[model samples]
Target: MLRPELIEFSLDNQKAELKIVPNLHGPITEDDLLQLLALPDFSYLCPLHAVITQAVIQVNQLHPQDEGNIELFFEIAERRDAEISFEIASDKMQASMALTAAYGGKSLGLRDVLQNLKLQRISMGLSKAKIEALLVEFATLSPGEKCHSVIANGRAAVNGSPAKLERKVSLARERLLQPQHNSDGTVDMRNLGAIIMVKPGNLLIEKHPATQGVNGYNVYGETLIAKPGKDLKFTAGNGTEFAANNPNQLIATVAGQPVETPSGMQVDDVLQIKNVDVGYGHVDFKGSVLITGDVGEGMVVKSHGDITVMGFVDSATLEAKGDITVSKGVIGRQLKDLSLSTKLIAQGQISAQFVQYSQLKAKGNILVTKQLLHSHTQTQQQLIVSDASARRGDLVGGKAEANKGIKAVAIGATADTKTELFCAMELTELKQQLKQLDQSIKSMVVAGLNIEAQLRKLPPKEQWQADAMMVEQVKVMLEEKRRTVVFRTQEELEFEALKLEIEGYYKHYRIDALKHVFSNVELHVGTAFQRTQREHGPCQISNKNQEIRFDYSH
Candidate 1:
């Protein structure tokens, strides 16, 4: 029997050694060597079994008693293949790269990794410092451990800003009507309303050009172009012109009030006054009018451009073709019945601090800061009665109409003020215009028929062969009448089409009311009307199925 201690194996089982100790009984034989090798457990070394067996045979043939130990079998360990992987991503603006360390292979140096990356064609945005750090980390990691690191990154381009325009013109002073505090902590109403007047050739606006943006660099060190800034052209409207020296500067041409509009800037011929009282008399200016003081009772102020009153408006009439802005409130005081007899009419918008016992109408929007009490207000667009702070925003009115919508913080008072609100009212003016157009079209059709009948009464062209001069004159007259008939027919067609379009626009009218609505409120949408007996909040009234419906969900 072979002793187990006769052969020795390494920990990894890659090599086997046989001990050649001097035997006390007999010399070692080939069978004894094979038995000793087999006893040491060489199953894991099956791939190298032939070499191991040959080595054992050589050892048996030598049988040197002097040699204490001999290497009987050896096998070189096989390793897993070295693997390298990378992650790359990029967009139009930036790019990035990451690296994953190779596993189960010989230790890699910085140079070796760099060579491998180069051979793999990853030359863009390579960071030497990051590569060195990854190599250092790779050197410290144990076998089968992975090291992942971000290697490269690219920068993004910057976009340019658009050109800006700044207006330097001033209009009426926008002053809040809060009580002024004195040194003794007493409050008083100190009117701060003032009119801003400008002379001719005054600077109205200035334009600043856009700036160029910076370019960017990609991972491959390629230049990325940046979007250039957009330029703006100066729009000088009526009564305004560009400066002679600088095109970016705008200057007023005539001495008037500077008005800023959506299309451009204009200077309206103005009529500036201290007040509209008995001494100053009523005013009806061709252009805009700026009153620095109040319009006393029984006075009128009318303008073609705009009417800007810097003080309170008494029981008077204010009319304008553009807009009407009253710095203070409109009060109809000392009236017999306290009805809203003071009228305010504007083709554009009407903005006021407060309106009480007054009648106001505008083709555009109506913006009130405080409240509308017992007044009648109508607007073609939205009606907004709220400040940014949402304080004193109440609409306890008699009647109000807004074709677009109405927005307020509170609708009625706690006493349940009877407020009548109408939205998307029927386009009566357009409908009337369409009716008149239809009448005109009918009249034109009749006229066209009459002209055709007159043209048909003329002699035929074949009769001209007998009398050339008479035929020529009659033919000219007939041709003129025929042209009139054709033109009238075209006009009739155009008018009919316009009437249809207006009818379609009137059919799709809608309105909405934001915030709370109280009791005793009558709402009218189109031709339908609804009265609320109980208070409903955050509701919207619209015309549906030829009936007024209230929607409280939103």
Candidate 2:
């Protein structure tokens, strides 16, 4: 086997600086210094700048232009700095050391000392005893060495990866010990490492026990909770399968507990997760939301199509033109309490949960759901929006008028008016009246003829008096009935006018129209579900009591 290299040292600025030489008379190169920085098993031996520069010059391979570059000068100054960092992170230390050395004052004899080392391959002119001491102090001279602490950084890795470095490993005390973990109860030596990293399979936590590492973790439930950590519990849990929350920090997995996954679902046209531990601020996605897990507070989710939640949503607004389905129940905000849209369909109802929408309809009646309380009319058409439960920022549903006068049901504050008044005259009633009128007209015709005949039969005075009384009474009754028919026609026209207005304002919207487009579109002012009793403050999140259905029109 090849012999290990030895190093020497000196004391300056309360730090021991090492000095080393090749076993041969050759000078060290940049590549040789790089190898020293990456040697994981042995400690490092860094020569003073004065020694390295002298050796470079002696080789006659030093670039003349290198001395003129400002960067080069700064680098040279950093190497000569009085401060010495005992860190193995050579890449990280290079910049720091350079800055420190550039500003540090140098001893007056640096040039003379450099020239002396240049003439010979001696150990910076230090005694062998001092050199040996430095080896012990720096730990580079040992047959084996190990560092307990590790620092991981992109810059620290320099031009390569930290994992791929060569290391000198120590033999274990026993040939083998128990396996770290095994469901099969057998050993797997394939996973062995010089440094065994301990990872917990799971932790059997106290039932509702207080979380040790974080606050708000006092156990109220059987399972251990991470307590809404700064990094989202669900976001990291789903977004990346393999992610390190605390860089360079070991992750301890608790047994039988699901770790937090960060999903990439967009919410309310805003809020997107850029990475495992990072999310874009208040973003908008017009197409689809693809989050891996739950959405945090105050986020808004809007979709043109259907909405799919991989996890839960807390105190967040969700809006969609099509359909909505959440894998888990919503929390932090009430569905029935908030002013949500009226046009919505969910497999579930808002029961102790948030039920905000413009108009909402479930397959079943709502007992605990607040949106279904105090409905305007639930029988005439299909669904009637409740009046008692909807809160501020809620939009209204469209209306369908059949028997209960005009009721506005859908969003956009529209109404539908359906009237059953048609002069209160059935064909039988009108036909009967017409028969009487016809009889009166026929009798009048006969009376006039009889008067003509009588005039010929008797004296002129008697004939005239009898004709006047009979014709006058009949004329009065006939005129009264005609006036009644005319009045009924006018009333019928008025009802028709109101009905036309319902169809005219089909899709027209005003004031935050995007927020309140009722689904049914057919609305009746006096008949449909209207917020007429109270003006719905500005349209926001809501679920209407009456679901606007598109059955038919006219």
Q: What's the TM-score of every candidate structure?
A: 0.50, 0.17
List residue ranges in candidate 2 displaced over 4 A.
1-280, 331-554
Give lDDT per model, in order: 0.69, 0.30
Cα lDDT, model 1, residue 324? 89
Error of 1 at 62 (Å): 34
Top candidate when judged by lDDT against the true structure: 1
What's the lDDT of the predicted structure labeled candidate 2? Answer: 0.30
lDDT of 1 by residue, 385-424 (tens): 8765555578985888888777777787768889988877
Instruction: Provide the global lDDT of candidate 1 against the true structure.
Output: 0.69
